[model samples]
Target: MTVRIVVDRDKCQGYGQCVFEADDLFGLDESDTCVAAAEVGEDRRADAERAADVCPMQAITVE
Candidate 1:
Protein backbone atom coordinates (compact mmCIF):
# COMPACT_ATOMS: atom_id res chain seq x y z
CA MET A 1 0.00 0.00 0.00
CA THR A 2 1.10 3.54 -0.67
CA VAL A 3 1.85 5.53 2.44
CA ARG A 4 0.70 9.10 2.70
CA ILE A 5 1.75 11.90 5.03
CA VAL A 6 -0.84 14.53 5.78
CA VAL A 7 -0.31 17.81 7.60
CA ASP A 8 -3.03 20.16 8.77
CA ARG A 9 -1.83 23.56 7.65
CA ASP A 10 -4.42 25.32 9.78
CA LYS A 11 -3.23 23.57 12.92
CA CYS A 12 0.51 23.48 12.28
CA GLN A 13 2.72 26.05 13.90
CA GLY A 14 5.89 25.18 11.92
CA TYR A 15 7.75 24.01 15.03
CA GLY A 16 10.11 21.85 12.85
CA GLN A 17 9.84 18.82 15.11
CA CYS A 18 8.58 16.78 12.19
CA VAL A 19 11.37 18.07 10.02
CA PHE A 20 13.94 17.07 12.63
CA GLU A 21 12.41 13.62 12.84
CA ALA A 22 12.15 12.97 9.09
CA ASP A 23 14.19 15.32 7.02
CA ASP A 24 13.56 13.29 3.88
CA LEU A 25 9.84 13.67 4.24
CA PHE A 26 9.34 16.99 6.03
CA GLY A 27 10.87 20.43 5.77
CA LEU A 28 10.50 24.14 6.45
CA ASP A 29 9.50 26.34 3.58
CA GLU A 30 10.85 29.79 2.72
CA SER A 31 8.43 31.22 5.28
CA ASP A 32 9.48 28.59 7.81
CA THR A 33 6.20 26.77 7.54
CA CYS A 34 5.93 23.01 7.63
CA VAL A 35 6.14 21.17 4.31
CA ALA A 36 5.93 17.44 3.68
CA ALA A 37 6.21 14.91 0.92
CA ALA A 38 2.88 13.90 -0.53
CA GLU A 39 3.61 10.19 -0.43
CA VAL A 40 6.12 7.63 0.84
CA GLY A 41 6.95 3.97 0.48
CA GLU A 42 6.50 1.23 3.03
CA ASP A 43 10.14 1.46 4.04
CA ARG A 44 9.51 4.98 5.32
CA ARG A 45 6.38 4.08 7.26
CA ALA A 46 8.11 4.11 10.65
CA ASP A 47 9.78 7.43 9.99
CA ALA A 48 6.50 8.94 8.84
CA GLU A 49 4.75 7.68 11.93
CA ARG A 50 7.48 9.10 14.12
CA ALA A 51 7.16 12.49 12.46
CA ALA A 52 3.42 12.46 13.02
CA ASP A 53 3.92 11.57 16.68
CA VAL A 54 6.43 14.35 17.22
CA CYS A 55 4.18 17.12 15.86
CA PRO A 56 3.43 19.20 18.97
CA MET A 57 0.29 20.63 17.45
CA GLN A 58 -0.92 17.17 16.47
CA ALA A 59 -1.21 18.40 12.91
CA ILE A 60 0.39 15.50 11.14
CA THR A 61 -1.09 12.17 10.15
CA VAL A 62 0.51 9.16 8.44
CA GLU A 63 -1.52 6.52 6.73
Candidate 2:
Protein backbone atom coordinates (compact mmCIF):
# COMPACT_ATOMS: atom_id res chain seq x y z
CA MET A 1 0.00 0.00 0.00
CA THR A 2 1.00 3.60 -0.56
CA VAL A 3 -0.10 6.91 0.82
CA ARG A 4 -0.58 10.01 -1.29
CA ILE A 5 0.84 13.38 -0.31
CA VAL A 6 -0.56 16.61 -1.59
CA VAL A 7 0.61 20.14 -0.84
CA ASP A 8 -1.45 23.19 -1.67
CA ARG A 9 1.07 25.54 -3.20
CA ASP A 10 -1.16 28.56 -2.72
CA LYS A 11 -1.56 27.83 0.95
CA CYS A 12 2.09 26.99 1.56
CA GLN A 13 4.40 29.59 3.00
CA GLY A 14 7.76 28.03 2.22
CA TYR A 15 8.14 26.90 5.84
CA GLY A 16 10.30 23.80 6.11
CA GLN A 17 8.59 22.20 9.08
CA CYS A 18 7.44 19.26 6.99
CA VAL A 19 10.99 18.70 5.81
CA PHE A 20 12.09 18.25 9.39
CA GLU A 21 9.52 15.55 9.89
CA ALA A 22 10.33 13.74 6.64
CA ASP A 23 13.23 14.89 4.53
CA ASP A 24 12.74 12.04 2.05
CA LEU A 25 9.15 13.06 1.54
CA PHE A 26 9.40 16.87 1.66
CA GLY A 27 11.88 19.52 0.69
CA LEU A 28 12.42 23.20 -0.11
CA ASP A 29 12.93 24.30 -3.65
CA GLU A 30 15.29 27.02 -4.92
CA SER A 31 12.51 29.57 -4.48
CA ASP A 32 11.99 28.38 -0.91
CA THR A 33 8.67 26.73 -1.70
CA CYS A 34 7.64 23.46 -0.16
CA VAL A 35 8.10 20.46 -2.42
CA ALA A 36 6.91 16.94 -1.62
CA ALA A 37 6.80 13.45 -3.00
CA ALA A 38 3.52 12.35 -4.59
CA GLU A 39 3.42 9.02 -2.76
CA VAL A 40 5.21 6.82 -0.27
CA GLY A 41 5.01 3.28 1.03
CA GLU A 42 2.43 2.51 3.72
CA ASP A 43 5.34 2.16 6.17
CA ARG A 44 5.90 5.90 5.80
CA ARG A 45 2.31 6.87 6.57
CA ALA A 46 3.32 8.14 9.98
CA ASP A 47 5.96 10.37 8.51
CA ALA A 48 3.51 11.75 6.00
CA GLU A 49 0.91 12.37 8.66
CA ARG A 50 3.45 14.12 10.84
CA ALA A 51 4.42 16.41 8.02
CA ALA A 52 0.77 17.31 7.44
CA ASP A 53 0.18 17.89 11.11
CA VAL A 54 3.09 20.31 11.44
CA CYS A 55 2.20 22.35 8.44
CA PRO A 56 1.34 25.82 9.69
CA MET A 57 -0.64 26.59 6.58
CA GLN A 58 -2.29 23.22 6.65
CA ALA A 59 -1.17 22.89 3.11
CA ILE A 60 -0.29 19.23 3.28
CA THR A 61 -2.77 16.39 2.89
CA VAL A 62 -2.16 12.68 3.23
CA GLU A 63 -4.47 9.95 1.93
Candidate 3:
Protein backbone atom coordinates (compact mmCIF):
# COMPACT_ATOMS: atom_id res chain seq x y z
CA MET A 1 0.00 0.00 0.00
CA THR A 2 1.04 3.59 -0.56
CA VAL A 3 1.12 6.15 2.24
CA ARG A 4 0.20 9.79 1.93
CA ILE A 5 2.60 12.42 3.20
CA VAL A 6 2.28 16.09 3.98
CA VAL A 7 4.72 18.72 5.20
CA ASP A 8 3.47 21.93 6.69
CA ARG A 9 5.80 24.54 5.32
CA ASP A 10 4.74 27.16 7.79
CA LYS A 11 5.58 25.02 10.79
CA CYS A 12 8.81 23.67 9.37
CA GLN A 13 12.05 25.18 10.66
CA GLY A 14 14.52 23.56 8.27
CA TYR A 15 16.01 21.51 11.10
CA GLY A 16 16.38 18.46 8.87
CA GLN A 17 15.49 16.23 11.83
CA CYS A 18 12.74 14.59 9.83
CA VAL A 19 15.13 13.96 6.99
CA PHE A 20 17.56 12.28 9.34
CA GLU A 21 14.81 10.18 10.89
CA ALA A 22 13.32 9.09 7.60
CA ASP A 23 15.53 9.77 4.66
CA ASP A 24 13.62 7.33 2.46
CA LEU A 25 10.33 9.12 3.03
CA PHE A 26 11.46 12.67 3.94
CA GLY A 27 14.26 14.98 2.95
CA LEU A 28 15.43 18.60 2.82
CA ASP A 29 16.61 20.27 -0.35
CA GLU A 30 19.23 23.04 -0.55
CA SER A 31 16.63 25.46 0.74
CA ASP A 32 16.44 23.44 4.01
CA THR A 33 12.71 22.91 4.07
CA CYS A 34 10.98 19.70 4.98
CA VAL A 35 9.89 17.65 1.98
CA ALA A 36 7.59 14.66 2.04
CA ALA A 37 7.28 11.67 -0.23
CA ALA A 38 3.95 11.57 -2.01
CA GLU A 39 3.80 7.81 -1.66
CA VAL A 40 5.98 5.85 0.67
CA GLY A 41 6.34 2.07 0.74
CA GLU A 42 5.39 -0.05 3.75
CA ASP A 43 9.02 -0.73 4.53
CA ARG A 44 9.55 2.95 5.17
CA ARG A 45 6.45 3.45 7.28
CA ALA A 46 8.17 3.04 10.64
CA ASP A 47 10.81 5.56 9.78
CA ALA A 48 8.18 7.96 8.50
CA GLU A 49 6.30 7.68 11.77
CA ARG A 50 9.47 8.39 13.66
CA ALA A 51 10.10 11.45 11.56
CA ALA A 52 6.65 12.77 12.31
CA ASP A 53 7.20 12.20 16.00
CA VAL A 54 10.62 13.79 16.07
CA CYS A 55 9.69 16.91 14.17
CA PRO A 56 9.85 19.80 16.67
CA MET A 57 7.23 21.72 14.76
CA GLN A 58 5.13 18.67 14.02
CA ALA A 59 5.34 19.67 10.39
CA ILE A 60 5.02 16.20 8.95
CA THR A 61 1.89 14.12 8.57
CA VAL A 62 1.30 10.64 7.19
CA GLU A 63 -1.96 9.11 6.16
TM-score of each: 0.93, 0.95, 0.86
lDDT of each: 0.90, 0.93, 0.84
Per-residue lDDT of candidate 2, residues 2-60 (tens digit): 89999998899998999999999999989888999998899999999999999999999
- Model 1 accuracy (lDDT, Cα): 0.90
| lDDT tens digits, residue span 1-63, model 3 | 977888998889999888887777787877888778888787777888889999999988888
The parts of candidate 3 lying over 4 Å away from their true place are none
- Please give me the total number of clashing residue pairs in predicted model 1: 0
Candidates 2 and 3, the one with greater TM-score: 2
Candidate number achieving the greatest TM-score relative to the actual structure: 2
User: Which 10-residue window of candidate 1 scores lowest in summed lDDT?
Assistant: 27-36
Off by over 4 Å in 2: none
Clashing pairs in 2: none
Q: What is the full ranking by lDDT, best candidate first?
A: 2, 1, 3
Q: Tell me the alpha-carbon RMSD of every candidate.
A: 0.8, 0.6, 1.2
Off by over 4 Å in 1: none
User: What is candidate 1's lDDT per residue for 1-63, written digit by digit as tens?
Assistant: 779888888888989999999898999888778889988898999999998998999999888
The residue-level lDDT of candidate 1 at 17 comes to: 98
